[model samples]
Target chain A: MRVALCGNPNVGKTTLFNRLTRSSAPVGNWHGVTVDVIEKRITGTDVILADLPGCYSLTARSKEERITRDGVLFGGYDVVLFVAEVNNLRRNLYLLTQVLEARKKAVLIVNMLDEARGKVDLELLSTRLKIPVVGTSERAKNPKESVLEAISKANAPSLPYLNEVAADAVARRAAEKNISPEFAALKLEERDAFIADILQSESSQRGCYGCRGCDRDRPSALRYSYIDKTLDGVVSCRRRYALTDKIDKIVLGKAALPIFFLIMTAVFFVTFETAKPLSSLLGRLVSLAAEPVKNADMPEWLCGFLGDGVIGGAGAVLAFLPQVTLLFMLTMLLQDSGYMSRVAFVSDGFFKKFGLSGRAAFSLILGLGCSATAVLSTRGIAQKTARCRTAVVTPFVPCSARLGVFTAITAYFGLPAITVAALYALGFVAALGALKIMRLFRASEGEDALLMEMPPYRVPSLKRTFKAVFANVCSFAVRVGSVVLGVGAAMWLLSNFSVRYGFTGGSGSSIMSTFAGALAPIFKPLGFGDWRAVTALISGVAAKETLISVISSLGGAGEVFGSAIAAASFLIFSCLYVPCVATIAALAKETGWRYAAVSAAAHTVTAYAASLIFYQSARLAQIDMKLFVVIWSSVVFAAVAAAVAHKIYRVKKRKGGAHDSAARKERK
Target chain B: MNLSDYSLKRGVIVSVGCDDDTHRRLVDMGLIGADFYIKSRRGGAALIDYGDFSAVTRNALAREITVRER
Candidate 1:
């Protein structure tokens, strides 16, 4: 048996779905979180539960709305569960009435009653609607039993008590088309495009609904009236949680954005402070374990490889697990507590000024966890170009892997903790700067207007939060243990061996250094032009997977960069450079490969330019011209590149002007 | 009056001024013809609430929605 759960956006449908299926669905206190229909089979039964995207009143306009509409209309189901937010029944009832009108085996699920605060007479509600109504809690241990039972005993009315216009249209259209009145009326009520297209020849300029003089407002008003009447007898809401309101006044108000930055800083401080000790402890333990491997009587080369390349690389990734887990936990808390939506809501003002939506902050926040996943999460965004633009720039936000590199480099240099914090801060500015530059100049494709509901603030469920943290950790571990491990081993092999797989005298004679030597001159201006620095840059394309291994093998960041200025420049370049190949693939999937390539090339070139500016400015200010010849070459290289870019821009502008004039003439 | 016009004041929705794509979406969110509580207004956006839910809307989009002083 196939059961389908459907409801309005953010109405706890997903929460209910998760509990019933014992699966972790991404639950956030915002609309359009579930953009695709996900199916999970109920355990210990032959029943598949498909959770459809939320919609309001079945009037399908956007793609997500269409998914819900199409699923309800065509996705064959034995039972239809309409999840309703208990506190928002006025709006929830509108959808419930629509489903009951379709005469499907429908049940009304009043979700989040534990938080409802208002008095609700479920028996009275069930009696009034003549449907099987069950109340659910987000933390309910046995929610599936009552819901499955309700499905077996559903008593949905055959026809909704419709507005007069719908009643007349149903009688008229049903007789004409030889279909049941309920089906005809429901289709007409939905203003379904398929129905309109079929009936268009007979109808005039107005659609089938409008031609029949059945305005959308009337039926919607009728639904609201029905809800008001039913609720007056069955429900009473007194102020449930004044604390939520009090908190929102501060968090969602005029002072919120500045306070939000502080809060985020605090979250990072807590995450790193708590996780740092344990991370180092794990690192030491791994080192201790590897000492035994080093002592084993294998080939001297093989022992070094096993002890350093394999164990050391894997240890670096494992050490990062604490930070990754904490980051995920904190983010999920913000998302669950409803603070994230408020932050995004307030940010709409700023992001819109830069031609992005407030929702871009959501992806940016997710990027702190993983850039590849963050780019994919923007699928719910409605504007095609805006979504693509957001995805393209998301990598600049610095994922956990990049954070690991920052930690390793800072610790290796014994730099102040403030330096690592500065890098995290730098990421936000860089991302917003990239967004501002790249998102402009595109032809105005109509953008998705910010229409998010700021859900009421609530306490995050720890069980759910911990479960989310666990899932994230498991996935992060798998990626690190597999992809990162593979890349690390490959990097070690190439940097260790000659072209004939002969073990080199040192990394200086390896095949990797030859490749690095060719790339070194290009980076001479930014100060980290050594062959070791070149290999770290090359391998960091896969991010921390190869960066730490390659760096340690090259005798560490201090030896590679040689000076604090050069080290800072190299760190800044690494921080702002192209994201890993996995993130690039996600970019390609979100936008086309052409735009992905453009985005990557733009990031790499600009990172070099910015690094040059930072390095040269610092050097010139300090009057340090010890390597005057190398420093002067960078200035010349930058000047030449700038001149070439200027020429290209002018030529493109001239062509564009001529094209615009020709098009204007043709119009005239 | 429009939502942008009543920046810090509470109002009941009188009518929605635009009827394109924005219309149905606003209605879907239950922002039409309902009593509203203005929470905050900043940076060309207003955070407002109907009795059951709160929403933050761009003032440009909010201008398309009209309301009556409560």
Candidate 2:
């Protein structure tokens, strides 16, 4: 049998779905975390459970809501597991009433009753609603068995308001359409345009007519009135959590943004400084593990290939797992505690000026961990244009995989904290700048306003947090063991061999150099034109971590860049270039290949220009301050002139297009 | 007065004078026809407590919601 979980947003529907199906489907404390229908079979059973996105009403306003309404109404599920929470049972019941009105066999699961201030009479609720109702605690432990049992005995709920408010319409529509009166009543109540039109046309075909002057608000108010009457003595509780209110005072107050930044600074400190020793120890262990291959007396070429190319490159990436794990853990903690939603709330004002919504912050912040998953998370943004714009610029927010390269380069420059922070800031600024530029082209598209609920804060579970961190680190390790290792071995072979000479170990005339040499001049203006740096840049296309590994195999960043300015420029370029292949594939999945291709090209060109500007400015500053000022002034002046000209051209084009439309209207 | 202009912390919703899209959204969230207590405001965005939950609405949205101070 197929069972579907449906409910209002952030009411633990996904969590219960996870428990029942024995699958993880990304549950968060905030709204709209799951934007698509996900199906997974229950373990040791034939039943398949589909988790639908949360919606406020079955009337369907947002895309996510439409998906849920369609899935529940037409997905052909045998049972609907309607989930609700006791905190706001009245409001949640509004959607439940709609679901029940559709005449589906459903079992109402009331979650988070353990957190409620007072007890709820589940038997009374079940008796009044005429369906099986199960109450669950905070963890919802062993809910699968009870939920399955409830499902087996589920019955269609009978809400009196449906019959009382739209009796004639429901009866007529039901007889005409050959559907249950309950579903017809639901259609009438929601004032569904398609069904109502069909009913009106069919009635008109005959001598009679459909219900006249349907009032949309009357049915909705009647449903709520019924819910209020039913829950009058069944549920007793205080709505607000006092601790959440107190915490929000400090976290969501006037100093919210500054406090968030300070918290992130501390997290970065812990990730980098506290995890340094373990990272170094892992790096040394990896290097030492290759010592056995070197001493085995195998052929010189075979030893170098195995020790330097495979283990050396992949191991360099493996060593940064400690810091990455720490960062992921801290980020997950913030999200689990519901602080990230508050961050989104505070960021809305700033994000609004950039033509993005507050929810876009979730994707961008998750981009700090990994761009592939971040781009996938853009599903939560309802607006199509905003979702696309957010996905295209998300890669500009450096992912954790880029941490190794940033740390290595900045450590050499003797200020890892300052420089790394600056790089992160620059990446964020670049992403905002990209969004702003995109707005100029698509400014005519209407944007949706933000309306998000703030979830009450809770302490993150340590065990769950560690489990998520472990899963993420394992995924990272698998990437290094697979894609990074393969790319490393390929780089080693290409850099070590030549068509002319079968093998020229450490020679300048290798296949990789020749291939990378052609691209060197393009980057020479950015100051890091060495073939080795170019090779690292090419390898980064496979995976960001591979840049550090390839650079390590090619005698480190010092040998490649040779100076601080060049290293900085390379870092900037790496931060802004095309995201890893996996992220591109994900981007293609989210936004089509056309947009992904354009985004990649745009990023590369933007990276080159930004790096060139930075490199030349630094070079000039080192030589003469007067000359640096003169050269940069002319550059800025020319850039301003170009921007003004572009603006004027666009204005003229828009006016001309409007004129043509007017002329066409006149002729018509 | 409008919710954005209301200086007091507690208010009762008089009417939502927003356009169709915003009005439907507010209704769906169960924010209409409810007593509200303003928890905080920043950058013209108001975080209000209504119907057993808190919602952070944009400045533009707040401006369209008429309320009576309690």
Candidate 3:
């Protein structure tokens, strides 16, 4: 059986699909999460279930809607499972009405049944609509037997009200194309651009081919009226302020921006702070695992290969699993709860100023976790320009891979964790700055206005949330095992063998060192030009964690830096240098290699320039302790002064408004 | 009144003069003949709730929509 899940945006279609298929298709509590056709087998049954992107109707107003229309029309399906939130019964029926007219069989699963108990008359609905209606709390509900039974016994329901002219036009088109009459009729009635083009090609004549459809704007209203009439018989919703509305009164107010920042800061704190001890513990465990392998009386090369080449390389990457999991889970939680939309919705104003849209916020936040995945998420963005801008900036944000490098290097220098936080902050600042610089040469175009849905905040499903987080963790582990381990093994072998094919184990006289030494002079101007620092950066392009291991193997970073200025400059270079091949491939997949190549080149050039400035500035201004403390105090005082002045200005403005109103009253 | 005039207020859409593509999308997205409420307004975009549907629309697009007091 080929079962397909279909619904309006944010209506738990993907949630139920995830549960039924045991697949993680990135169900966020936002609009347009699923943009492509996602199909998987329904276990224990000979069934293939597909999830289509959400659309309000059978119309193609956006990219996702187009995908949905094509999928449902062309992808032959045995059954359509029309998933909808019960509280949204009226809106749900609009699509249901259209689908049942064309589709063979469907089970109406009223998700969020907990909220629609007495208000929904299911039996009356089942009778009126002439279909099996199953109520489910999709937030946390098991598959009911009725859903399966309904799928097994597939039958088309009675067709609802259809305009005579529209039906005839649709039937004629269906006869010509030999497609489903109901689906084709509705698509033609709705004036679907794709269907019109298809019919246009079949009929070379310019005259009207089939039935004369209603006015362009009439079909949608007609559908809404049909839905309203259908609901008048079986559904009743009491007008009440929902919990989401009450919460929105505060969350959507002026304090929303600060609240957003606070949430992000807390996430950062939890990820980095909690991952510290856990990372150390993992590193210790890896060392313990390696001890026996090292002492196993095997040949020296074999032990070295097993110990450092495989175990050590994989271990270095795995040690940061804590941070990776934390970041991934937190991002998923935000996405699931629907705050991610609000964050995007609110940020549109600020982003518009930088030639980006509010939708870019989703990709940027995901970038903090992993640039490769972040680039993939940009598919959710609507506009082409916005998507491109988002993909280009994604690599500039420090990803989980680079985060581990930053943490490891910070610990090496005994720098405060705050130093790492500052670098992360710098990444965002640089991203926005890069947007401004990049936009200068291109023809100026206004940013797309935000047209996003703000889904009601719901408690994220723990099962699905953990499922997504675990899937991400597994992917990261697999990458470490394959890509990072391979790169590490190659680096280890190159360092151990000389160009003359002699094994000089400890000395920096091997092919790797020789290759790195030649490149060292190129970076000498930035202060940290040592062969070790330069070599680590070259390896970083393969895998970021490889840089950490490479630095360790090529005599420690401190041994290369020799001063705070050089160390800071090298860290900055590391922060902004070329993203790993995985991220580049992801970017290429999303846009094209032309964009991917530009991103790689931009990062490399920007990294060099930024590092030069940092190195030269630090060298020019010797910061004594007294001068540092004085500068920090002055900045703190200025911030406090600005806040007080803003408060006073607000107070005066309110008073003046009151006085002006009183004067108007006196004149009256 | 037009949609932009009903800031932070709830009303029912009377009619939408969709002279352009954006307003056409609004009507097609089920924004017409429904109770419309604004949650917030920022950067020329109004966050609104049309019945069970929620969306953010640019103020320019909102001007094309007409609404009546509920």
Cα lDDT tens digits for candidate 3, A161-209? 5534355655676768756665665555555656667765343221232
lDDT of 1 by residue, A527-597 (tens): 98898788877878875446765676545667888888898888788878888898899889878899789
Candidate number with the higher TM-score (2 or 3): 2
Q: List the residue pairs that clash in candidate 3.
A: A170-A185
Cα TM-score per model: 0.86, 0.89, 0.87
**Candidate 3 overall Cα lDDT vs. reference?**
0.75
Give me the runs in candidate 3 sitting further than 4 Å from their true place. A101-104, A139-141, A167-174, A181-190, A201-214, A239-241, A291-296, A444-450, A560-567, A622-668, B17-21
Q: Which candidate wins on TM-score?
A: 2
DockQ, every prediction: 0.49, 0.39, 0.39
For model 3, what is the alpha-carbon lDDT of residue A422? 86
Q: Candidates' interface RMSDs, in order?
A: 4.8, 7.5, 6.6
Question: Which residues of candidate 2, in runs, are more than 4 Å off?
Answer: A138-140, A165-214, A412-415, A444-447, A630-668, B17-21
Compare the candidates by lDDT and give the number of the best one.
2
